[model samples]
Target: MTSPILLTGGTGTLGRHVVPLLRDAGCEVRVLSRRAHQPVEGVQYATGDLLKGEGIESAVDGAEVVLHLAGDAKNDEVTTRNLVRVASQAGVRHVVYISVIAADRVPLGYFRAKLGAERAVSESGVPWTTLRAAQFHDLVLTVLGKMTKLPVVPAPGAVRLQPVDSREVAARLVELTLDKPAGLVPDLAGPKVYSMPDLVRSYLRVRGQRKPLVPVPMPGKVGRVYRAGGNLTLEGADLGERTWEDFLAERVR
Candidate 1:
């Protein structure tokens, strides 16, 4: 059997795609879930909880690679530190983590936790690779949905973003697992940049909702950062064919 790969968050939006890709690559995949479920053809489910540090050692015992992708934003730092400690003890050869782009750069609560997690992964004794990617298309879609339902469609002033498809991100993740650890790879972003109002309009056009867009400035330092393109990777690498429009067209209608 090939070296075992243990994936956390294997049932998530991106993980769902990665599990199959790894299996197709002839890897023995073990996923850490909270409860037991019928196993897939070549996959094993290990019961574990990062928050409580339960079942982690057993999960990491024999796996050569550990893909750390599970964690709630609120407590990601705790999860990451715990996972790293166990993976180091387990002698895992390679640890790969998925992170959002500018996790350290962004001051959002979740981003701060992600930055801490990244720090943990970097300091883990095991070899590791961290891929920081742009926000997922589904997230942008959610924002659009919320904006359209508001009393007025107010857009963040000059706020720009580059959203990538989660599946494409998953494919890159699988590719990284196959190669030697390269530390931090280039930031992954969408092919194009988009303004908030434009994205909302694109979403509205697809949904057949006609609404007037009221452009407004986002308050606070976070807003200022976004307005200045803090959340964007205009010069980063990209690996997604499905645009925000493409995702909406396919999924919304």
Candidate 2:
């Protein structure tokens, strides 16, 4: 019998899409979660906390491939380090990591943590592949939804985002998880880029609401990076088919 594949972040936005695909591909899956869950057919739950370094050894045991999708705004490096250490000890064959576009270039705590996690995976002694993707449509929608609640939306000047569908990203990650390890694959981004105001306008249009948009200039090094498109993959990147408009059409309403 083939060993089961280990999956982290198995209950997250991306993981929800990945689990069914992996199951349909005829692979048994073990999902690591902080909370307990009843096992389903071909899928088992391993209770673990990557940040606290608890239950990882048992989670990784006997798994050949690990798809690490769990992450947070902070401490991703520490969590990934903990997972890789156990994965190495377990003699896991491959470690697949999903990161954000321009993780190294973006000057933020979250981006820095992601970059650190990438380093941990690469140096883990296990064969590895990392794919950087743009912000998910779900995340973008949440941000815009909050902004729309305000009387006047604050649009960060010169800030742009290419929001890709989480399902598309999940599909690509499943393919990578099933294939041989390939290091640092080309980035994946949404087909179209939209400015902050454009995104806000689109959201308003979808919701049939009108509100004034206040242009707010982003300042300092972080602002400079965003203005220069440090958070973007403009060239040599795999583009997802779903547009932000397509996502809004389906989700908002």
Candidate 3:
């Protein structure tokens, strides 16, 4: 029989996909959350808050592996440290962390937080693995949704994105959980690289919107990084199966 697994952020986009995978694999799954949630088949929920370090001990108790998926890009450092402390005390064996691509190099605040969280996991004195992935397609849609509301669409001409499906990322995380603790795995990206204009046009196409595409530069160090492809993983773009356009067409249309 396999050991029980403790998951943080089990209700998140990626976590929701992962829980069923684990359950189908016949592994007992325990979820840690901040609020009460109705029961679901093949899963158990424990109330906990990572920020204030409340209810974490019970969440980590007797769990051989801790799959950490929940994090606030703004304050994940504290949350991650709290998790590490509790999980370590509970004698958890392996900790899996999900992070963004180029988190160590990016100048963005959230990226910085991810890097700090990665360090927390690595330095926690427990066997751990970290998987850094490109932006999820859901996030891309959120950005596009905001742009569609504007009278005119401002498109970033210089930036490119390879948005992977969150489901694919979840699969990779599950695979990593079963493998021996490798420090950090290769970055994962979508099947194709798309410029900001290409993605926006596709959004407009699928949504049947004819909003004028205004070629605009995103102003800031973050924008400059994006324009320079700092957020992209060129070699990793071949990792996932789904493309941004297909994702939009299937989900958004």
lDDT of 3 by residue, 1-253 (tens): 2657999999999998999988877888999999988877767899989999999998888889999999796889999999999888888889999999999777978999999999999999999999999989999999999988999998879879889999999998998888889998899888888898888888888989888889987788878888788888886344898878678778875
Residue 145 accuracy (lDDT) in model 1: 83
Model 2 reaches what TM-score against the true structure? 0.99
RMSD to the true structure for each prediction, in A, is 1.4, 0.7, 1.4
The candidate that achieves the highest TM-score relative to the unseen native structure: 2
- What local distance difference test score does each model get? 0.87, 0.96, 0.89
lDDT of model number 1: 0.87
Off by over 4 Å in 1: none
Candidate 3: worst-modelled 10 consecutive residues by lDDT = 235-244
* Local accuracy of candidate 1 as per-residue lDDT tens digits, 100-139: 9889777789999998999999998889999999999988
Superposed model 3: Cα runs more than 4 Å off: 236-238
